[model samples]
Target: MEGKRVMAITGVHHAQITIPRGAEEQGRQYYCHLLGLPEIEKPESLKGRGGFWLQVGDRQVHVGTEDGVERSSTKAHLAYHVTDIMAWRQRLQEHGFQILDGVPIPGYERFETRDPFGNRLEFIQPLA
Candidate 1:
């Protein structure tokens, strides 16, 4: 077994989203309180930065503050599924989130919203 490749299986341990300056608290509020994800405590080595890290089920979301990059396409947004799509939409609307009425994307109900730093995100639910 020494110096040989083994046939084992593993999956993605995490995913990350980088935001620009001053968006940490907003990201926390949205991902933690609003979306109900558990806030993963950052290691002491990664603290004192201008962003946050959050955990969603088995995945992780890392929000880092960039210096001067311009925000671009919303097409690369993250798509999340919820138990009640309409209710989620309403809740976001009630919180002043800019909701975009998206076209039917073949097999799912979808909508889009922008984060505090202008990063776009999507939410979709499959019709059952």
Candidate 2:
């Protein structure tokens, strides 16, 4: 027992989406406008690093800028629970965001959309 490892489960505290430096603008347009998240300024010290913070209710998502990293939808993703799926889809399309129609996630209805840097984002809402 002295070397035993313990796993703790508490709910998700926060999540960060990493994008290439200078791709923050695309994140702002797609996430802030389409998803209705408020953009909070990244600290001045972090400004030069190229990222922005978005406030999503009690959770915070930090979009960070990673230099020279190819955007890959296969690696990481963020799933958001949205109230209005159709409205969000329409708005995102109008803004020229590439959205992929996907099958429902079993217990939940969901779809996928890509950010400017190709980060895969999923929009989901429980089926009534």
Candidate 3:
């Protein structure tokens, strides 16, 4: 059994983040309008549940609703691979979003920002 094959998993299918109840519109605006992620329809069975889905290239980001005060974590976050890190930084700043510099990682340029609900998000571009 030294070389027995195990279950193979491909890339990520989706990443889910939660927002406070009644904040779905805010989530939609930030993800769809500002981030430019196209909104995807949720399945009929899940439509009764609040929140929506957005397309992220081949993957998806599922924004769900939670019943409680929203609190953001400083450490846990979603990092996305991008083509132009600086351009994204500028775009976010232009939209009145605060950009935070990420700790230096060799061969990678990245920065951090928050969504409307204060969820941490990171964008990274490989250094040439």
Candidate 1, residue 7: CA error in Å? 7.6
Residue 60 error for model 1, in Å? 0.9
Compose the digit string of candidate 2's lDDT tens values, residues 1-128: 48878898978777988877676777787678757799887788877877889988888899887877666628577888888788878878888877887775677777888887778888888888
Model 3 clash tally?
0
Worst 10 residues of 1 by lDDT: 69-78
Give candidates' CA RMSD values in order.
2.6, 3.3, 2.6
Model 3, which residues run further than 4 Å from truth? 1-6
Cα shift from native, residue 102, model 2 (Å): 2.5
Q: Once model 3 is optimally superposed onto the true structure by TM-score, how far is the C-alpha of residue 16 displaced, in angstroms? A: 0.1
Model 2: what TM-score? 0.79
TM-score order, best first, reads: 3, 1, 2
Write one digit per residue (lDDT tens) for candidate 1, span 56-79.
667777878886765556466667
**What is candidate 3's lDDT per residue for 1-128, written digit by digit as tens?**
59987888877899998888788898888889888889999999998899999899899999998866444655778898998788899999999999999998999999999887888999999999
What is the total number of backbone clashes in candidate 1?
0
Candidates 1 and 2 compared: the better one by TM-score is: 1
Candidate number with greatest TM-score: 3
For model 1, the local distance difference test gives 0.78
Give candidate 1 misplaced runs (Cα > 4 Å). 1-9, 72-74
Which candidate ranks first by lDDT, i.e. highest?
3
Question: To one decimal, what is the Cα RMSD in angstroms of model 1 from the true structure?
Answer: 2.6
